[model samples]
Structures are given as C-alpha cells and as structure tokens.
Target: MKIRSFFTAILTALFGIFYLPSANAHALYVFAQYDGQVLSGKSYYSDMAPAAATYFEVFRSGIEEPILTGKTDVLGAFNIAVPDAPNTTLKVVVEGEEGHKVSVVADRTMVSNSSNDNFMLLREDIAHLKDKIYLHDILGGIGYIVGIAGLIAWLNSRKIKQGAK
Candidate 1:
C-alpha cells in the first residue's frame, strides 16, 4: 500500500511536467519607453506564455545567470535595473512553473537612468526547481511497476472470489 501511494505521487508529478510545452519558447517584446534609463522594472506578462510558467526573470545585459527571478506582484509586473543599462540591452528572462525559460530586452542609456537602483531589490529573486522531480519514476519503472502492481491486485481479487465460489 505504501509503495502504491508513492507511485501515484510520482505519476502526478510527471504529468505536471509534461502538461505544458507551447509557452516554452519566446520571440520578443517591443514597447515604448522614455529615452531616459530607469532602473525601475516594467510590468510583464506570460498570459500568452506557456501554461507551466509561474513567474518571469530579469537578467542583466551581460550576466550569465539572471540577476533576479520571481513571480510578479498583483500587476504581473517586476521593476529592476542593473548598475546601469549604458546604451545596452537589458534582459528579462521569464521562467515558468513547469521550468520553461524565455527572455525579453529593455534598452537604456546612462544619461536618463533612474535615481534609485536599490529600491527594487527589497529581496532577491528565487528560482523554481520543484517541477523537475517526478516521484513516479522512483516508486517503480513506468512499465514494470505499474503493470505488476495492477496484475497482483487483480490476481488477489480472483483468488478471493474462487474461495467464495
């Protein structure tokens, strides 16, 4: 019984991962903004994004990893900035609940940059990784465990019926 429950949990987790794939890839977004650079983050959305993603990530222009990543506030927007955009492309990467990654860009220059960069860093952004695990794989192999468990349960029922007969 314990093993059976474990397998069920695994199956549920796996289904969750494969559940959505369309929003995984991103094209790009172009919007109007002042020529002035502001560390202030802009509102973004995954509305048309894949069903699996829960939040967006903002990656600084040259940084290998994202400077920050997280779910948006009620507005589906995040405000952030690197030390300066400096006539460079600012990257905003969106990560989904299911582990999909996508990015957008915001360009800016030093002359018009915002007054405060620290105001947006109230707390650091965290990555979502729980979606990667599938417990179903551990309870047993997909074919062997599920098939054997079903057969055993059936056989036990048959034997009980014969005894009654």
Candidate 2:
C-alpha cells in the first residue's frame, strides 16, 4: 500500500512537471493599424494580458530593412507617424524579453481607414472574436483525458482483483 501511494505521488508529480509549462505558456500577438498617417496598436499574450514594454519593429513588405523601431508603453500601446504613402504594405514585429516574438502584416486597406476611431473599432472587433478553435483538437484532448482516467481505473481494479486472489 505504501509503495502504491509512493508511486501514485511520483506519477502525479511527473504529470504536473510535463503539463505545467504548456498550461502556463503564452503565445504573443501584436495588432497594429495605421490611421492614414500614424501607425498605432497594442501587443498581448494569449490570455489577453498586455505585453508591456515590448520592442516593436516596422518593416516594409519585401524589404529586409526595418523602417522604424519603437517600444510599447506601460499599457502595451505604441504609435508612430508614418508617411502618406498609400497602398504600402507594412509588417510589424513585437519582441518579448523572454524570446517570444509575434509579427503582424498591415496592408493599405488595414491602415487606410480615415480616422483613429475607425481603426479602434476594427481593433475592438478583432478583440471580441475568439482565437481559432479546432474541433479535432478539442476532441483529441477529451479523448486523452478519458483514456487516462480509464487506465487509472483499470489499474486500481487490477490491484483489487489481485489482492482478493
């Protein structure tokens, strides 16, 4: 019985060790828009937490050189005045200190909105939407949970049967 309890504790600890990293892990995402002249936006993690003080780089599409570099404010907000170039493609990259990086591409249509209010409305629209959720992925996770529970139950039943024998 003591050996079983010890093994159970070890198994639980091992499971925790393997699960904690992914469970706590966050994927970074940056969303930016240019309202005709000023490019501005925010960076956030998977949990919708602000990615504050992160460095951001702006690049022209198909150009290897960064056009501008800036850092987010305390609220994860950033703004930079851009040229009045219409139909330009811009790429924005936000880098986190923990080696996490997220990039977003903005085309003319994205930033050509006349006012900041329009840009902000677009941001709010995106913010309200949920991230992509695949049906198969969810089903697979459910299957894994059910399988693990069944295996544990089977092992317990086997122990009971053996003890009765």
Top lDDT model: 2
Local error of candidate 1 at 147, Å?
46
TM-score of 1: 0.34
lDDT per residue as tens, model 1, 29-106: 212122343433433322332233246655655668766656655534454434544555656655544345455465
Segments of candidate 2 deviating more than 4 angstroms: 1-23, 107-115, 132-140, 144-165
Candidate 2 per-residue lDDT, tens place, 114-138, comes to: 5567666677457535543345765
lDDT for 135 in candidate 1 is 50
How close to the true structure is residue 97 of candidate 2, measured as C-alpha lDDT?
66
In model 2, which range of ten residues has the least summed lDDT? 106-115
- Candidate whose TM-score is highest: 2
lDDT of 1 at 74: 55
**C-alpha positional error of residue 161 in candidate 1 after TM-score superposition, expressed in Å:** 66
